[model samples]
Structure formats: structure tokens, C-alpha cells
Target: MPLSQSEVLAGLAEIVNDETGISADAVALEKSFVDDLDIDSISMMTIVVNAEDKFGVKIPDEEVKNLITVGDAVNFIVGAQG
Candidate 1:
């Protein structure tokens, strides 16, 4: 079975937390990494790597800039996993 939206979001939270040293509780479904989490470019790349490894999906470099929120990351994972 494919992962659900919540599952994807949870996975993303785990990735972001592990990379940025931020607690998962600090992030929300609607949170923006830059505006809310204060994530820098390097941390964002860390998130990308973590997501890729966790989901077993390769996100193209060009699409990296497009992932701005938790929902965006979830959508990307769902699309790629399909």
C-alpha cells in the first residue's frame, strides 16, 4: 500500500527534526521551514537527503526549491512513490 498523507508528513517531520535539531512538535502541517522553522539552505538540503533516503525516492535538484512547506514535501513524496 502507498503511504498516506499523514504518514508522509510524519516522515517529513522526522527528517526535518533529525537534520535541524528541531523537535517534531515544533513543526506543523502548515508550517514553512524558512518563515516558521528558520531553516537555512543547508538544512533544507539535509531534509531533501533525509526524505530521499527515507522514502526511497530521488528528488531532482531542480525541484528542490519547490518544496517550501510540509504539504509540499508530502505531495512530492506521494507523487514520486506512485
Candidate 2:
């Protein structure tokens, strides 16, 4: 079954929190990973890898660059699951 946006968001929040030590509550659809979350590129890659494993979705490096906001990542993961 494909994950819903909120499901993916919650999962991604956990992954982000695990990687960056940021509060999962801080993660929201409008937040930018870099500007809002202050996630550097290295941490972003780690989060991406973990998200792939947790969500069973493949996020290409090219696509990773395009995932600017939290919602973007969640939407990508949801779409990729299909």
C-alpha cells in the first residue's frame, strides 16, 4: 500500500530528527530542509538514504536536489511508492 502524505511526512520527520537531532515536531510541509531545518548536504543525504529504506522508495540524486521543502520529499516518496 502507498503511504499517504501525512504518513510520509511523519516518517520523514522521524528520519530527519534521527539524522539532525532536530525535533520531529519542527518538520512541516512548508519548511525548507536547508533554510528552515538547517540541514546540510551530508545530513540531507543520510536522511534520504534512511527515508528510502523506511519508505521503500528510490530518490535519485538528481531528484534530491529538487526536493526543497518537506512537502516535496513527502510527495516524492508517496509518488515513488506507486
Candidate 3:
């Protein structure tokens, strides 16, 4: 079965909180990874790697570029897993 949006969001939030000191409560769909979260390129790549392992989905380098917001990542994981 495909993962729900909440599952994806929660999983991503955990990864973010683990990798960064940011609180999980601050992670929302509308938040931007770079602007809102202050995630640099290296951190973004780390999140992607961890997300792949957690979600069991392949996030290509090309697709990663399009994932500007938390919602974008959640939607991508949902669609890819589906």
C-alpha cells in the first residue's frame, strides 16, 4: 500500500529534526526547504538520502530540484510510492 501524506510528512519531519536541530512542529507543507528551513545544499542532499531510505522510493537528482517546499517532497513521495 502507498503511504499517506501524513506518514510522509511525519517521516520527513523526523529526518529533518534528526539532521537539523529544527523542531518538527515548524515543518509545514507551505514551508520552503531553503528559505524557511535554512537547509543548505549539503543538508538537502542528506535529507534526500534519508528520505529515500525511509520511504523506499527513488528520488532522482532531477526530481530533487523541483522539491522546493515540504509539500512538494510529500507529494513526490506519495506519487512515487503509489
Candidate 4:
């Protein structure tokens, strides 16, 4: 079955928390990765790589530039799944 947006977000929360030690609750849809989660460029790439593995999606290198927020990542993965 295809993943839902909520599922993608929930999984992303775990990935963010695991990588950055931030609270999963802090990874909301509107939260900015750098501002809210304090995710640096390296960590952002890590999240993308890990998300790709977990969700079976390929987040292109160029497109990774656009994933500024948690919602953006979720939307990308959900769209890729379709």
C-alpha cells in the first residue's frame, strides 16, 4: 500500500529525532528544519537519505534543496509514492 502523508510525517519525526536528538513532537508540518529543528545541511541530507531508505523513495539531489520544512519533505515523499 502507498504511504499516507501522516505516515510519512510520523516516520520523518522519528528520523529527525534519531538524527538530531530533538523531540519528535517538535517535528510538526509547518516546522522549518533549520530554524525549528536545528537541522544543518549535513543532517538534512542524512534525513533525506534515511527517508529514502525508509519510504522507498528517491529524493533527487536538486530537489533536496527545496525541502526546507518537515511538511515539504512529507509532501515530496508522498508525491513520489504516487
TM-score: which candidate is best?
A: 2
Tell me the RMSD of model 2 versus the true structure: 0.6
Per-candidate Cα RMSD to the true structure, in Å, reads 1.1, 0.6, 0.7, 0.8
Candidate 1: count the clashes. 0
lDDT of 2: 0.94
List pairs with backbone clashes in candidate 2.
none
**Segments in model 4 whose C-alpha atoms lie over 4 Å from true places:** none
Looking at model 3, residue 43 earns an lDDT score of 92
* Cα lDDT tens digits for candidate 3, 1-82: 8889998999999999999989998989999999999999999999999999999999999999999999999999999994
The TM-score obtained by model 1 is 0.90
Q: How far out, in Å, is residue 59 in model 2?
A: 0.4
TM-score of each: 0.90, 0.97, 0.96, 0.95
In the predicted model 4, the residue pairs found to clash are: none
Clashes found in each candidate (C-alpha, N, C closer than 3 A)? 0, 0, 0, 0
Stretches of candidate 1 off by over 4 Å are none
Instruction: lDDT winner between 3 and 4, please give it.
Output: 3
Give all candidates' CA lDDT scores. 0.85, 0.94, 0.94, 0.91
Write the number of the candidate with greater lDDT, choosing between 2 and 4. 2
